[model samples]
Target chain A: MEIKHEKIKTNLQKILPAKASGDKWDLHLYIAGQNPKAVTAFNNLKLICEEHLKGKYHIEVIDLLKNPQIAHDDHILAVPTLVRKLPLPERNIIGDLSNKERVLAGLGLVDHSELKLV
Target chain B: MKKKERPSHRNILPKSPTSIQGLDEITGGGLPKGRPTLICGGAGCGKTLFAMEFLVRGATLYNEPGVFISFEETEKELTANVASLGFDLDNLVEHKKIWLEHIHVERGEIEQSGEYDLEGLFIRIHLAIESVGAKRVVLDTIESLFAVLPNQLILRTELRRLFQWLKRKGVTTIVTAERGEGAFTRQGLEEYVSDCVILLDHRVNDQSSIRRLRIVKYRGSTHGTNEYPFLIDEDGFSVLPVTSLGLNYSSSHERISTGIPRLDTMLSGKGYFRSSTMLVSGTAGTGKTSIASQFAEAACKRGERVLFFTFEESPSQLMRNMLSIGIDLQPWVKKGLLQFHATRPTLYGLENHLTTSIKLINKFEPNIVIVDTINGFMVGENQTEVKTMLLRLVDFLKMKQLTAFFTSLTSETENLSIPDVDISSLIDTWLLVRDLEIGGERNRGLYVLKSRGMAHSNQIREFRLTNHGIELLDVYVGSEGVLTGSARLSQETKDDAEQLLRQQEIGTKQFGLERKRDAMEAQIVVLRSEFQAEEAEALKVITIEKARNERFTQDKIKMGKSRRGDVSIKTTGTKKKKYI
Candidate 1:
């Protein structure tokens, strides 16, 4: 019975790598409508994730004009807000994610010193 | 057919009266309903307090539930700060009458990454309003959003949208902002929220702080344009609408005694009119306070409430001083018929003093209000401001049909001239108390300079502060003008002596004339008797001489007749004897 239980636990761990590694970043970007700033923010965020987060992050685009009721869940004040969820403590970044280094540092994916040379 | 366009009076908007003292009168009714009213002021100028009071008063007095969204102060701090003003925000929240939301925005914690709208704030406010079914809303210092939010354009847009949303919600709103340099509000919030804009100012003039409120703009409404002074006491905000008080106070035909019999006699023998304002102006040591105390005592004696505001003396000191003169205000105070509010003139600005006294007048509902030494209010204010404030106060008192007595201290040489504040014209009755320094003695003299609609004595009365209150004596008007004090006493004594001396002289002259008349009568009686004796002697002599002559003449005639008439006499004698 113990051996069977251990085998099931290892299989479950292998099946859920996103949870086992604890390195997955779930980001939700809030926007009023399909504006240029939202588009730029989406493109910039996609680039940052590809460079740093790679496959360890999932991006959810939420248009506030369509789903404005959910904006308060993450305390979104300004449009195109970047909320990093699924981490122990949630953090928010306002404006379009133009500064890749500052965005990386804010998401806790990179240290300030690591981005100093870049 | 040409039709004249008549001015339509059908589109008048309803207002929400805040029930604040003197505020409704200036706003015509109150703030505009279902619209945003911006209350902007400098730091510590009572912006938050004003908004909170509006909401609280609206909720309590008008039965309108409210929502308070504070961006700077927390619910606990806000509640505690307004607790001193007797507003129980917690209890209101518990009863679901008010909803208080504290939105803390830390500048360090927020970062600008992308464009966003303030939907979160809107959602929170909506939820608060809906939860409490609020009809009134207050955003205390919404300028804090500018400190935390980096995008000004987005913030401005969201703010404009929020104001419109509030209007759509049909809730009267008060949005507080910080005052900017040379602008009504910081960030020029007045440009967008133009429905109603009120500016509050906290300024220190002559080391005393005064808070003033002025409606910069009120659309579709006529409001007082002058800056009104407002006071924040335990009760709440009381705005004194100085210029808004029209000269339409109702006049009363009733009369009230001035407590001094002689003074009352001087004032038409019926004292002042019931709602008349009396100004007792005097120099130093002219018994102004004494007169005010007497009036207060008289009001209390008549079972009317009296509020005595003394700026130069404390309550205990005044009581003790009045006690020495047998006024005995302690009984009236204990009976709750009399109240004394004593403070230093330097403690507050002139407007503050005015508002405070007005507040007390409203609370106590005094039939008579006596402000001892209105000159004390001139310590930290200009003469014009003082006079304006006094005019407003007198107007309010008269409107309420309350007898108001004001005492003023003039300069020694100024006499009846109210140098500190020229409120004589506003006064219905003006009694000028002066110090008559004559014959090396100082005495108080009181005379009515002007009394409207009543025949008052113009003669100066010597005012004496005896051990039993004030006594007004008729001053002696002799050759040296109106004589009072020792001069009057000496003049009266001299007049009495002169009168006595003249009476004595007249009495002696009458006595001498009577004695002379008696002697003349005696002389006439003696001369009459002597003349009678002489006439008797002459009569006796003439009778004896006439008898002798007649006898001689008779003898000669008888002898001649005997010779010629022997025969005729014999015949006549014989015939007479025969006829007999």
Candidate 2:
């Protein structure tokens, strides 16, 4: 089983480079201070990215209070703003990321109808 | 008496005067000091302008620095908008007298995910206030938050707390909000700021849009409740409160000329009282403008500035017409002593006209002001509004001790009644110029209808527009009533002819009496001569008869003496002598 998993990972890496140069999922979570909403959004994004993207995804956490000027770069107006920067079309989902279906759909990671079956 | 006995509540509340034209008087002073005043209005109703003006005026006029926090518009947009009004907001900001902040809250860009308050906004305001040491703070349209934030509960609590914080900050603040459908303000901002709420409405009446302002609520204060009409022009906002000025203007005993000598004589030989309002009401072609121009010319000739507001004629047209009448107003215009402001009554709303007139009056500072045909102002306004505006204007003029003349065009059909505006009571002197159609000719007749504190003429004089200006001639009053125009000349000629005929008859009667006295004197002289001749003839005849009787008497005496000698003895000689 291990030899087969290793062979599948090598095949995935070989095909992923042909599709895109960077990681499949590049997410940026914007938070101001240690807000509970920001913390919850960070944990939810981590869990979803690990389950769906595994090693193909990357996450960047931005503390607005520490680096407030960076918030203007992505036009972050509210705390706990999640920006999807990797795909050809960038998207933004702002909230505590409590709704799994909506977060997954907003991130374009999973189809909306498929979440009901899960 | 009752008013005096009542306690004056106006003195109890310490007020910060806004210094805005007509607003201070309407608000009884201004917005309550150090309290938030919510100003709500629809789009383009002058909410932002009013707020900015308040801040600008407060900073400039009252020497108080202000902070402006704009939620909808950028600082550059605000600066450009108010720059037209001659308010150099950028200069003021650079001078540290005013601080402007643009709090941009885009609805789609900002998302409230978790529990949050408007601490960011509060801190920014605090920094701005501290930077300028502001006494007045303005939050323009706080309702923009309702669009940006999804959590209304947090917003409401935060807004309430913000107001309380502003109150505790001890700064006189103004919060502007957008008017909502069937609500005084959108997002129910009126509930949060309970100190004062002023609502501005832009309504279209008779195809003309007029902005009106009303104080919906003022806590712990008595304010004007009437809906005041305000105007937004090059010079910010000016609210005209109708009849807000009571009868408290100081009266002047000095007299000013009406520009016509005969007309002056008609007004008790002195003219209208100084600082008094004079209404000249006349029908069409009754020389109302002529008289108004004459008064303006007279004021200008006195080296006093004159402001002529003409609604019917242009400045050049008026100047040319007056020149034709020998008034020579062009000189005054060239000398800068007379100013002619000609505009159509429909150019703006009634309130706009009032504000424009007031601004012009202030800028020009004329000693005498003449509004040619005030009836022109009645074209787009109701009767009550016209009367109120006139009253307010007249009161303002009287307060400033400026002589004012208002001309009104009365319809020919309504000759018996006064002008349509019914400003007779507000005017101190009312001159009625009417068209007197008599003997197949129409002539202008002028009479003083009323003079409040002077004994004016009761006789109607013929109003004539002559080459040397207005000339008032006495109308011929005979058994056929008043006769004017050619009829007066004919009547005068007939009277002169009859007087001459009567004088000729008296001369003939005196000549006949003189001739009869001369003939009687001559007859008396002839009678005296004839009597004297008769007396002479009688004397001669008596002497001759006496001589003849003496001769016969001598013979008879001789005979009687002989007989007497003979009879002497016989007794009858005495009888013979007696018979002789």
Chain B TM, cand. 2: 0.84
DockQ of each: 0.27, 0.10
Compared with the true structure, all predictions reach lDDT values of: 0.83, 0.82
lDDT of 2 by residue, B321-382 (tens): 88888988888899999998999988877777888888899999999999987876786638
Interface RMSD of candidate 1, in Å, is 3.1
Q: How is the predicted docking of candidate 2 categorized under the CAPRI scheme?
A: incorrect
Off by over 4 Å in 1: A1-18, A26-55, A58-74, A95-105, A110-118, B1-10, B111-114, B419-421, B501-580
True contacts kept of 1: 0.47
Overall local distance difference test of candidate 2: 0.82
- What value does the lDDT take at residue B274 in candidate 2? 86
